[model samples]
Target: MLIDASSVAASADEIRAGAVSGIIFDMDGTIIDSMPSHAQSWVAFVQNHGIDIDVPDLMRRTTGRTGAECMRELFARDMSDEEAWQHIAEKEQLYRELFAPIFTEVAGFKAFAAQTRARGLKVGVGTAGDRHNIAFAFGHLKLPTPPDAVAGGDEGLAGKPEPAIFLEVARRMAVPPERCIVFEDAPFGIEAARRAGMRAVAICTSHDAAQLAGPHVLAAARNYHELIESKFLERLHVEPA
Candidate 1:
């Protein structure tokens, strides 16, 4: 369901009144503008194996899923766990290679992360990317220090549209799900956040804002810069440092 801007504001107000204390972010599209690179890598990988799948369909089906899950879904065949891991590793290596030179964070993300930390809000990462991808991101991107907690797909957590990853992040951060707000770029991640009993803000990095809209979302922004400009974080009533 597409929510109007007024409804977004209302949801933000409601979340503020509810006392949000922590924030969880999804990595790929939410923190870094690497979706296109990722999609390109997927296309290259599949084509190399003589598989013919549309890039858009690949992205839509796999965005918030682990590489192993994505591989299985894309191939529509079962493989041994070892075989799955091998495919995941190779594909992610390709992703890292393709993404390294052009790596960039979402606009205003570094400053916003620092500010969120300064404001005493716990920060957590809930992502479907494996640890290698997470390491690559942190090692290459010009962002703030690592988040207080991280829950990745490699941890055996169920991927997005299922609440396990988000729930695990909230747990590791010592924040209750109800008091945590999630920042996500995919519809599946938004659904996962809501299912975990948290409010979500959509980062429209990969999809249009309207495509991301749903009842559980508080607002949608192109990047953290827009959120900051509009005082969206302030509306959460985070304490000053």
Candidate 2:
């Protein structure tokens, strides 16, 4: 169901002519190149608990899921709320420690964000990462401006492929689902955006363009630099502030 880049480019006029008014970004892989650290943390966490798992397989299954959801899936057992939270906290703490020194934004993301804001478009972040990870990103990245809305997994929203997180972010941004575009790095996230009735651009950071392809994906790019160079954002027809 994946369309080619040319087709997406051909839809530029339609996108610019009122089809999109907001942009929602997924945090870990899409906004920042921290998935390696995340994967390592997951491997370390599972091994520490004496569980054996293939890191890549585990990552694919849990990429867009909440920590609690991931634990249940990983262990194949139901857990009390308190136990789930404890494990999530521990795992995320390890992830932070591993990623702290090397944290970096995806190439050209900051500039693109600034341009989007200058065009007066609503901007939001929707992520399966918890509040602590969110705080870590804000502290390290030092974004030029805070997002208009942020919907995180710790907020008790259903995770990706369910549409709840993206839907909530759109709501908080005061934009309708059909009028927004989502940037994502995972298949589940792409599905979530489509289920929320929005267009999506795949960020091929953690996965290749082929792996990220799907019917709802408008385009695929390695970073914002490519998106800009290819006129992807120009297709949105945002005017200068």
* Model 2 Cα lDDT, one tens digit per residue, 54-121: 87998889899998898888888999867998998999999999999898899889988887787778
Candidate 1: residue 119 lDDT (0-100): 77
Model 1, 84-123: lDDT tens per residue? 7788898888899999999899988888898788778999
Q: Tell me the lDDT of model 1 at 222.
A: 81
lDDT of 2 at 26: 97
lDDT of each: 0.84, 0.86
Model 1 reaches what TM-score against the true structure?
0.93
Task: Compute the lDDT for candidate 1.
Answer: 0.84
For the record, the alpha-carbon RMSD of candidate 1 to the native fold, in angstroms, is: 2.6
* Candidate 2 C-alpha RMSD relative to the actual structure: 2.8
